[model samples]
Target: MKKLQLIGLILVLAISYQCKDAKKETQETMSDEVEATEVIVEEVVDVEIITFKMEPKSESMVQGEVTFTESDGMVSMSAVLSGLTEGEHAIHIHEKADCSSDDGKSTGGHWNPTHEPHGKWGAVEGYHKGDIGNFTADEEGNAVVEFETDQWCLGCDDENKNIVGKAVIVHQGVDDFTSQPSGAAGPRVSCTGIIN
Candidate 1:
């Protein structure tokens, strides 16, 4: 009887130890799963977008819409325009967001926060921050201009990179890329104020 009782006690202890070990393993697994869930939640990012309309300037019938999208430290601009002459034209970001004047000169000169000279967008010699070059209008007088850059921002703290208080100007002629000040891109045909 004593031997039987001793054997039974040993069996109970062994079973209890295994149950405790199993519970500990389950708790550890639960902790690891929680950490993985937290890591996944931290990887999300935010995107910002702004859209505005472009009006005719300098007695031209040109009109359009401009959109700016910011994502992962990069800004993209898309402009859809109509009522243009069927040929190449110049587009740029001017210093001020004001478009009150009939000639679009109220927006001031090209956006040159860095005081760089006029040239191509990525010219080795020099280039203004607003030197966006040129795009062609289709036979139907409709054009879609798309540009992307990490050098510009929307409603950001950096004054040199922020584009909120600026203007989009579509010129009637092509950008020579060698002219000083404003690239001699001809009359501003379309204008839009980029307000925050």
Candidate 2:
């Protein structure tokens, strides 16, 4: 009887030891899973992309061609505007380029690229992300503007968040960054929508 009792004690000890080993293994597995999840979250990858086109609004009395194309997350914009009276017009991305009218109500405000107020359309950081600036329509009412900047990258995850949903607005006058709001550009003469 004493032997039997001793055997019972030994069995219980073995079972307890086995349970401890299993618990340790389970903890290790959980740790591995957590690490894998973290890696996945850290590898956030997105290439910038944008597709846009603009047309002749009633306000767009000028015959201009604007095109935006994307490749490998990079975009290129080109504009050839004619029929603009001989002067500088503030050209930039508008809040929304619905172009439903000449009052420029269809299109919202300037692109304000850097989220800065309106300015003389040079290379002001916060002026207008889309503020390419002062395309002077000649006696023939024509102007061609072209340039590139990373300031606006579509499909970018976090940097430029409100790009895809914005419009391109052409103002009747130049943009002076210090100006209260619209750079006193009378109104929106043209607009284009950025689509997928």
Candidate 3:
């Protein structure tokens, strides 16, 4: 009778140990699957990228690369330029994508699809959709520009505010913002077409 009782106790202990091991294995597998799913989700987020290469007007080494990324309802722009005079410089989206001219005038005027007068960005009234303000160049002749806004879209989905097929112009002077027409931003130093 004592032997029988001992045998029953051993059997119970073995079953409990096996169940614990099985539960632990199942939990580890689930943890690994969750981690893999998180990685996959991170890899699948949608982001549209557009790039532009700016060519100097003439006798200027002012070259740059601008990248635009669209996510959600806003577009983010980043530009890295070199060989610029130290000070503020104006940047804007021009009416046409034509940058073939040596002086960059071939790109046409500032993009004013909304017919809004030239003014500071985020103003209560009178502001061109292309009025992107200015960027300051360091003493080393390098400039970095970055901003995010929902005022512009990648395509011409809303009226003509789209910038995909337009030209981005880098001016030699600062955009005074309050100046009539185009903020008197001066001549275009570099121009590039925005493309996907």
Best candidate, lDDT: 1
Q: Each prediction's TM-score against the native? A: 0.79, 0.61, 0.83
Error of 3 at 120 (Å): 0.9
Weakest ten-residue segment in model 1 by summed lDDT: 39-48
Model 2, residue 130: displacement in angstroms?
3.0
Candidate achieving higher TM-score, 1 or 3: 3
Model 3 CA deviation exceeding 4 Å by range: 1-44
Please, what are the lDDT tens digits per residue for candidate 3 over residues 1-196?
9999999999999999999999999999999999999988776576678888889995577899999888777889899999899999999988888999999988888889888888888888788777788999999989999988987788747856578778888999999888888899887888898864
Q: Name the lDDT value of residue 76 in candidate 3.
A: 92
- Candidate 2 residue spans exceeding 4 A from truth: 1-53, 57-60, 71-74, 112-115, 120-125, 159-162
- Put the candidates in TM-score order, highest first: 3, 1, 2
Rank the candidate models, highest lDDT first: 1, 3, 2
Instruction: Report the lDDT tens digits of candidate 1 across residue range 156-196.
Output: 99999999999999999999999888888899999999998
Task: Name the runs in model 1 displaced over 4 angstroms.
Answer: 1-45
lDDT (CA) per prediction: 0.95, 0.66, 0.87
Which is better, 1 or 2, measured by TM-score? 1
How do the residues 5-110 of candidate 2 rate in per-residue lDDT, one tens digit apiece?
Answer: 9999999999999999999999999999999988776653333334344455555585566766544444667777766778887777777647667565677666
